[model samples]
Target: MTHGRSSNILFIMCDQLRHDYLGCYGHPALKTPHIDSLAERGMRFDRAYVQSPVCGPSRMSTYTGRYPRSHGTTWNSFPLRVGEMGMGDHLRPLGVRTALCGKTHMVADRKGMERLGIAPSSPEGRLMAECGFELWDRLDGLHQRASGKQPTHYQARMQARGYRTDNPWEDYANAPLGDHGEALSPWHLSQAHRPARAAERDTETAYSTDRAIEFMEDAGDRPWCLHLSYIKPHWPYVAPAPYHRMYGARDVIPVVRSDMELRDPHPILREFHRNRVSQVFSRPEVRDRVIPVYMGLIKQIDDNIGRLLDYLRKSGQAQRTMIVFTSDHGDYLGDHWLGEKDMFHDCAVRVPLIVMDPSPAADATRGTVSDALVECIDLLPTFIEYYGGTVPTQIIEGKSLIGLLHRSRAKLREVAISEYDYSVRKARVGLEMPVADCRMQMVFDGRFKLVNVVGFRPMLFDLAEDPDELRDLGADPACREVIVRLTRALLDWALRHHCRVTVSDADLQDAIGGEARAGIYLGCWDQGDIDQIIRSGDSGY
Candidate 1:
C-alpha cells in the first residue's frame, strides 16, 4: 500500500468502546484477540478522545472533522442541521467511491441517502451518498428494529420466529428489557424507554461484515472508502448465547475505584452513584450478574471484529487496505460507580484509537504507541490528507494526524476538547423540561487536567500525580498558579472553538431560574447538581 496513490481505507468503529478494555492496553480481563492482533500490526494512540461523551455528538465530530458545537449537533435527536458539510459530503466530488455498512447514527434524509448510494433511505444514507459513495447495504431499522413493518429479509425472519417478552406475550413486547428497576435508573417507567431490539434479532458483526465484504468484491479495481460501523458493545448488554456465556461471572473482577469519584463531583455523578449504591451495589449478587452480561456484549463485538479481519486477510486485501479501529465514546461500565457516560473524567472521555498504517516502516512500527493528545475530529482531515482530498474550510476544526501516522510525530495539539448538552440531561430527569442551562468542559494536556464546572469552582489535577482524580488541587494554595494557567487555556480553547465560554453572572442567574421553571421534582440535590439528581417519583402521570 503506497502513500499518495489510490488505496482502500477501511474505517471500523464500535459503539461505546473504551481504551482500557483491550488486552494490549493492559486490561488483564478483557479478551479482544482480533483487536489486540490489529494493535500489534498498527500504531495505537494512548490518549484518544471524542468531541462529546455521547453517541450523536462523538459520531458527528468524527464524520465532520468539526467540534460538536461547530457542527451544530450537541445532543441526540437533534439532527445534524441539513446542508451541514461533512467528510462524506466533501468526499463525493472526488473520484473516490464511498460506501458505508452498519450503524451510521448521523442524520441523513431520504433524498440525501439515495444520492450517497444506500438502497434504503436512512438519516446517514443521504449524507454518505452526497459525499460520493455509490454502493451501500442500507439497514435503516436495525437500531430500533423496524416497528409495524419489515425492512429487510433478516428482519422479516426475526419477526416470523417471534421473541421473548416479559409480560402477557402481547404487552410483553419482543425486545429485551434492560431492567430499569432502580427508581433513579434511566430505564424507569417515566423515562421514555424502549427495548432497542430482540436479543435474538440483534445485528451482529456477521450482518455488517458480510455487507462490507460484498462491497469490497463489487468494488473490484477502483479505490473506495468504506465506513464499516458496528453497533455492538452498546446498550441492553445483550450478546448471543455462546458469547453471552463465554465469560464466567466469577472470573470477572468488579473493580469500582472509590477514588474515580471526584470530591464534590458533578451533581449528576452524585445522583448516578447514589442509585448504583442503593439499587445496584446494595445487592452484590445482582450487580455480579450485570458484569458478565456486559462483558458478554463486549465479547460479541470482538468476535465480529475478528470476522471482518479474517475477511480482509482471506480476500488478500489485508496489506492493501488502511485499517483504523475506534469507538464513538467510552462506556462507564461501573467505573467510579457509574454505568453510562457524560462526564469529563478519563473513564468517560478517554477512548481507544488505533490506526494501522498499510505502508511498511523500517522497524515495523507495528505495536508502536503514541501518547499524543488526539480527538475524533482529527480523523476526517487525516483521511482527507491521506487520500489527496481537499478538506472543507468553514466546517472543519480538527487537525490532520497524518504526520503522526507517517512519521510518529506526537506533539500535534496541546489540548483536546469534549462537549455535552443539557437536552439529554433534562430528558433523563423528566419533561416538558426547560432547556439545560449548565455546561462542563475539560482541558487536558497529557500531564494535567482542568475541569471547569459552571457556577461551581473549577478543578485542576496533576494527572501524572493524581491518576484516580480523587484529590482536588484547585483550592490548594501551592497549585493556585497552575490553576490560573490551565483556566486561561480552557477559556482560550473554548472561545476559539466556540464550544463554550466562561459562564457569566447572568448565566448563573438564568440557570437558577431555569431550574425552577423546569418544574423537576427537587430532592437532596439542587439544580446546581442536576446531573446528580434523578426524579424518582413514579408519576409518568
Candidate 2:
C-alpha cells in the first residue's frame, strides 16, 4: 500500500460480471457503492480487456501474463499446460505467499505432471496442479445437477445447516421455494426471479468473502497475495432473501440490441445465435426476469465487498495492500444476439478495472479515469513492479501500469488484443470448421474493431459510428482499407507475442558479443584481428 518491499495484493475477480453493470461504469440504477468507492479512490480504466472471453482461458492469461495461445488453455475445463509460470510461480520465491479463496477455473495438467514424475502429493506438484496457488479454500461452484458426483463442501455446509437435499447446491443455494413447498430450479426464467431457499449469509458470495477474511486473519503479518474470487452473478442467477427482489423489470436499462443484427450475420455469429443460451436470452420475456436476479447477485457481492473493505481498514491491512478489483470477462447476456462470452464484443471482453494504490506517488492520479487500451496481462507486471522487481519482458507480454498509476506520462497503445479458440465449442460443428481452424482473434483500436476467424470472412465494425456495434463493415467494399489496416495491426501483435519464455533479455544481450569471448572469431584472418576485435567495446560479439 505504501512503499513497502513486500506488499500484499488483494486481487478480487468476479465471474460473468459485465463492465457496464457497475455504478462506477455508469449503470444508472445498480448502486454498487462498494466497487464504486474503489474507483473514487483509485484509477479506473475505461478500456481494459481480457485475452479470452471464457473463464479458464481468460483467467489463465490473467495469471500468467501471456496470451491464451501461449498458455494453451483456450476453453473451460482445459488444463493450463504444466510449466507455464503463474502468479504464484513468479511471486512465491520473492517472499510473497500466494493463495486462492475461490474459483480460478484452472483445470490441472495432471498428466503433464505425471509424465515429469512430479508426485501429486508433493508441495511443488500441488502448486503446479492448481495453477500455482496454495488453496486457502477453493470452490469452482459450477456444479451441474446431473453430474452424479459427490456433493461439494458447500453442499456439506448446507447439510450442516439443516438444508439437506439430493443436490443442496441446486436445491437450496440456487433454487427458490414455490408456494407448494417445492424447490424450483433457477434455470426456469420465471422461477429465477424468486429468492433462493438459502439464507443470505449462506450464499456463495458471502461464503467466499467469509473464507477470504479467514485467510487474511491466518496470513498474519507476512507479505501475501490473496486471489479472492467469487462465483455468483453467473448462470444459476439466483440471490438469497431480500437481494433477489432488489430491482424489478422497471429498473432494468433498455437492451442494447435490434432486429437488424440477426440479418445476414457472420457464419460464426449465426451459430452463436443458435445456442440455447443465446436464444433464451434473446427473448424479452426471459430478460425481464433473469436480468433483475443477476443485478441482485451483483448487489450482494458489493455488500460483501463492503464487509471486506471495512475489515481491511479495521485490521490495518488496508494501507499496506494493493487492492485490485476486476472480472475475468464480461457476460454477453444476449447482447449482439449472442450469449456465453466467446465473442469479441465489448460486452464480452471489456471489463471494469480499478486499482487502489496506497502509495503517496499514486496520490496525484487518485480517482482519475484512464482511456488507455489495456489487457488483463498488465496486472502481473504491475504487481511485480510494486514488489520491487524488474519485469521480465521476454515472457511477460504486458507493460506495467505503475507509471500511469503514479501519474507519469502515459504511453498510449494503438490496439488491445483478445484471442479465443472455439474448437472445443459445440458451434464448431454448426460452422463446420476444422479443429485447427476454429481460432478467433479480435483487434480493437478503441474505435475500429476487427474480428478474424481462421476459415471465414473477417467481421469488422466502426464503433465510432455505431457504438452499440450494430453495423458490420467487414463485407463493405468501401471499408476494405480499414479492414486491411486492422488486419496488419493484428499481424504486428501476433509477431510480438513471446514464446521463448525460458530465454531472457539479458541472455540475448550476452549472446551478442560472445563470439570474441569464446575465441571463435568470425571473418578473422589472424589472432591479431581477433585481438583487436575483442579489444573494442563495439566488437561484433
Candidate 3:
C-alpha cells in the first residue's frame, strides 16, 4: 500500500460534466472509452453530489473541504475569505510541488477570496500566491454581463496560436446560437473541424494538459499534486474534430429528456425548464443532433485524460500515483428541459467521482458502482488522511472516501448539502433585478431532497419515487411527515454550518402557530408573530 518517493497525484476535473453521460455509468448511446477505462482501473461512485451546485461554489468546496456555508462562499462572484484553510495550503506544508492548470475560477476579491477559503485581506494577486500553488495558469475573468455570442477571449487566444479554424461547433451541440436547431450538419464531424484548426482554442485544455504531463514526467524523486481542469463540456461546448464525429448524432443520450411536468414547482425550477426547452430541447430532431456533439466533448476530455494516464504509466509512476476524476457539478443536458447545473436536480447536483489507488485490489470496487453517497467536500480529507497529514477537526466538514475505498464505509453521514446565494434572487422572484440578499440551502439524504429558499417554501423531492425529480413532494399531504422531519434536519444542519438565522421555539410558535420549532430561520417568515419578530427585532431562535 506504500508508494515510492516520486508518488504523484493527478486530479482531473471537468466542468458541468455528468456521470450518466459516460458509458461506464450505463449510458447506452454515448461512448466514454477513456472514462470507462479509468473506472476499470479504479472505483466509480454512483451517488456523488457537490456541496454547491454552481461552478464557483462547487469548485471552492472541493478545494476547501467545507460546504459553501462553512467556507462562506455561496455563489459565483463571492471569493473565499482569508484565514480559511484549503487543500492548497494543506499540500504546500507537506512540501508537495503543487500546480493548477485550466480554470481554477478562484476569484480575486475580498469576498471571493474569503469564500475560496483563502485569506480575505490579502493583496489582489496574493490569494493565488498564498493558495500555495507553485505554478498556475489562471484564465482572465470574463464579465458575465458581456454581450457576445462567441467566446471572444478563447477565440482570440486560439487564433494567435494558429489553432485550426475549421468546423468549430462540429461536436459542440451546446454551442450558443449559430447552430441553434440546425439539421444534422456533416459539418459537425471531425475531418470537417480538426483540433489543429479549432478557431476557438481552449488554451486551458491544450496547455494545461501539456503542462500537467510535463510536470508529472519531470517530478522524479519528489511527490507532487497537479490539478488539471478542463473547460470543455461546459458552456460554448466546442471541441476539436474527430472527437465531434466519434458518435452518431442519434447516438448521444439525453440525460434529461424534455418533460413538461413541474409538479409542485418553484419559480427557479420553472424558469430553468423554460430556458432548457427553448435553448436546447426545442425539437426531437434537434435534441437527437445535440446529444452526439455533447458526447463528443466528453470524448475529447476522455482523450486528454488518457494522454495523462498513459504518460504516467509509461514513466512507471502509475502505481505510485493516485488518480481522482470528477466534475465541479453535473450538467442538465436537456433533462427536465434544462441544460446547466444551477438548479438542485440530481442531474445538476450529482457528478462523477472516480478514485484509483496505486495499490490495486483484487476485490476492489474497480469498474463497479457504489451509492455510498459521497460529495466534493470529502476530497480534501481523503487526501489528507491518505497522506497522513494533520487535519484540524473544525475546518474539515467532509468525510474521507478512503474508508469506502477500503470497503469499511461504516457510520457515513446520511446526507450531503449545497447552497446558493446569487445577488439576483429577487429578479428570479420578479421583484427586483439584483436582490443581493438572497440565499438558498439544499439538503439531500440520497433519497429525499429539501431545498430551503430564504424567501420561499422549501422544495422537497422524493428521489426514490421520482428519480427524475419531476414531481415536487414538498407540499404533498402524503409526504407531510417526511417534509417536517427533513425540515428539522435541514434546520439543524444549517445552524451547525452557521448559515441560518436563529429563532426561539416560543417565538416561532407565537409567530407561526403553537407548533413552531427551534431551528434556523430561512428568511423573514410572514406569519403575524413572525412578522412581529421582523418588526420587534426578535426574529424567532
Task: Identify the leading candidate in terms of lDDT.
Answer: 2
Candidate 1 Cα outliers beyond 4 Å, as residue runs: 1-6, 108-125, 128-135, 138-145, 148-150, 157-202, 259-268, 274-283, 361-364, 426-436, 497-541
Give the per-residue lDDT digits (tens) of candidate 1, residues 1-541: 1353557789888887777877778777778898888888888899998888888778878887878767677876566655466666666565567777766666544454445555545555544333323437544223444456544544543445563322211222123344562212223322212332334324445566667777888888676778887776665454455555666557567554565454565554555566543335334464465556556667766777787788888988877778888988887656666667867678778888888878654135678898889988888877776677755544577887777766756467888778777555633353233455455677888877877765556767787997866666666789878878878887787677343333343455435434434655445344545543334322122
| Runs in model 2 lying further than 4 Å from the true structure | 143-156, 165-167, 522-541
lDDT of 2 by residue, 206-228 (tens): 98899899889999777888999
Taking all chains together, each candidate's TM-score versus the true structure is 0.77, 0.95, 0.77
All candidates' lDDT scores?
0.65, 0.86, 0.66
Best of the two (1, 3) by lDDT: 3
How many clashes would you count in candidate 3? Answer: 29
Stretch of 10 with least lDDT, candidate 1 = 165-174
Candidate 3 residue lDDT tens string, 27-118: 88776787788788788888888887788788888987878877676777676666566677777666666677666667645555556665
Model 2, poorest ten-residue lDDT window?
Answer: 142-151
